[model samples]
Target: MKKYLGEGLLIVFSVLFALFINSLAQKYQTSQKVKVAKESLLKEMEQNQVIMTQWKEKHSKILKHIDEIIKNDSLQEELIKDHFLDIGALTGQENLISSLVTSTAWETAQATQILSELDFDTTQELTYVYELQNSIINSTLPDLVDIYFQRETHRKESLLPTLIQFKLHFNEIVGQETLLVTLYPGAIEKLQD
Candidate 1:
């Protein structure tokens, strides 16, 4: 009877050991999956930040044009509102994007308020272009032009081209800037204006 009792105790210990080993294996697999998911998220965040930085740099180049439009006496308040809206868009601020998408609306509402004081029709395509050009000339369009060209060249040469290049192309037409600046007006001439 003592011998049987000893054998039964050994069997119980073996079963517990097997369960502990299985639990350890499961924990290890779960930890690995978590690490991999974290790495992928970090990579995605880094890539998005890079693209946003590039977009902001490009927006800086075209501020002059935007300013020119804002100052136009003939421009409608509605047109200026749109200009402000687009300008707010270039910043890629989280709060701004959230508000605009989920009931936050752009900080451009301030500009829109100022715009509401004036009365003019902004729907005509030709007038809209002229106002937009004027606003952009005074705004930071030059910076954007430089950034766009830089990225375009980088894309043409690099192998690991990101979807960012395609994203930039999809954004609204701000201005038609050839990748080559020398072929266009010198930056010095723009500053002189």
Candidate 2:
């Protein structure tokens, strides 16, 4: 009877050991998946920065053109203030996406006030539009890049090749306005394949 009891206890221990190992393996897989999700999110944010850069370049040229037309350096700076709403806010500002947009809209209101005051000629406006292709949007791109890389360094594991691939994909998409989009409204529809 003692021998039989010892054999039963041995089987029970074996079962429990197997269950624990399986649970650990599952947990490891889950951790990897979370890392992957975080990596993908970072890539998405990078691509959005590219789009923002393009828009900033275009807007800058537009403002410069307006300034040239108006023949005032003040107008150029004012246009930057107007388009960005707050130059300082964008320079190295760190905030979540929602608050950033709100701040930008505020600066834009100021720019619009200035734009409204202008009496631009059709030829000058047409020339501004023509320059759009060459101009670079200097929006919140650099800072955005910094934030993403910083976040990834903290992940500590499951830093797969997909992270590099995603960076490559982002570089390819940069300057491609089709991929650039605002954070709200139809952005998801535009972003998702």
Candidate 3:
């Protein structure tokens, strides 16, 4: 009976040890995955930051030109007299082009449930940043396109109204871009940590 008892104890201990080892291996694997996800996210954020900064600068410049055109009657007259020929020139480009900000890494992380591994603060900040980015893409870009097309179609009969609309939309977009640009750094820092 004593020998049987010793054999039973040995079997239980072996099973427990195996479970402990398996748990440690699972944890190590999870940590490694989190580390790789963080690195990918950090790189993505850095690239987005650069793109946002560039777009912000471009938008700010365009906004300044729009402000000047709006405030100065002479400039408006010149623009109209020229048949709005310099609209592109005023905007510092032949066409107003928007740069797209990417969120693939963040989306992939979320899809894979990696975001749950992140701390609350990091996840919250990234969510805010990406939400704002999606807002710009979904809301602001379409409005800008509408304004641009409206300006193109009605420049002869409704120049001032289109210009005013453009001003309002551009102002809103620039403000959004500025806020988003400010957010990128903090999110990147959290991921690096």
Candidate 4:
């Protein structure tokens, strides 16, 4: 009876040890995954921040030009007299400032369920930044394009109105970009930590 009791004790200990080892291995794997995900997210966010800054500067310049044209009656008259022929020449082509901003890493992390592994604050901040980016890409940009492409039979009559609408959209996009530029560093720091 004593021998049987010893054997039973040994078997129980062996099983417990195996389970502990498996649990530790799983934890190590998870940590490694989190590290890789953080690295990818950091790199992607850095690239996006650079792009947003560049576009923000471009949009700011365009906004300034729009303000100048709107404030000065002579400038408006010159544009109107020319039938707005030099409008595109005055303000660089709209398409030139509309470069594609990417969010592939953020999207991939979401799709793969890796964001669940990230800390709550980091995830929340990243979501906010990406949502703003999506807003710019999906909504603001399309509205700007629509306004630019909308036909006007009398360019002189429509110049002021078109400039006003363009100013509104550009102002919105620049504000969003500025917010994104500000948010990016915090997100990157969290990821690095």
**CA lDDT of each candidate?**
0.36, 0.39, 0.83, 0.83
Q: Assess every candidate by TM-score.
A: 0.37, 0.33, 0.88, 0.86
lDDT of 1 by residue, 53-163 (tens): 443345444343344333553432433244222323333332211210010111232223322322233112212332343343333345434553553423322311322
User: Going through the candidates in order, what is the number of backbone clashes in each?
Assistant: 34, 6, 0, 0
The stretch of ten residues in a row with the least summed lDDT in candidate 3 is 148-157
Q: Report residue 17 deviation for candidate 1 (angstroms).
A: 0.7
Question: Candidate 3, after superposition: displacement of residue 111 in Å?
Answer: 0.6
In the predicted model 3, the residue pairs found to clash are none
lDDT (tens digit, per residue) of candidate 2 on 74-168: 53344345433332332223222221211232233234443232234422332232233223223334433443455452242322232343333
Regions of model 3 farther than 4 Å from truth: 77-87, 94-98, 151-153
Give stretches of model 4 more than 4 Å off: 72-87, 93-99
Q: Residue 56 deviation, candidate 1, in Å? A: 2.1
Give the best candidate by lDDT: 3
Top TM-score model: 3
Q: Which stretches of candidate 2 lie over 4 Å from their true place?
A: 66-193
RMSD of 3: 2.4
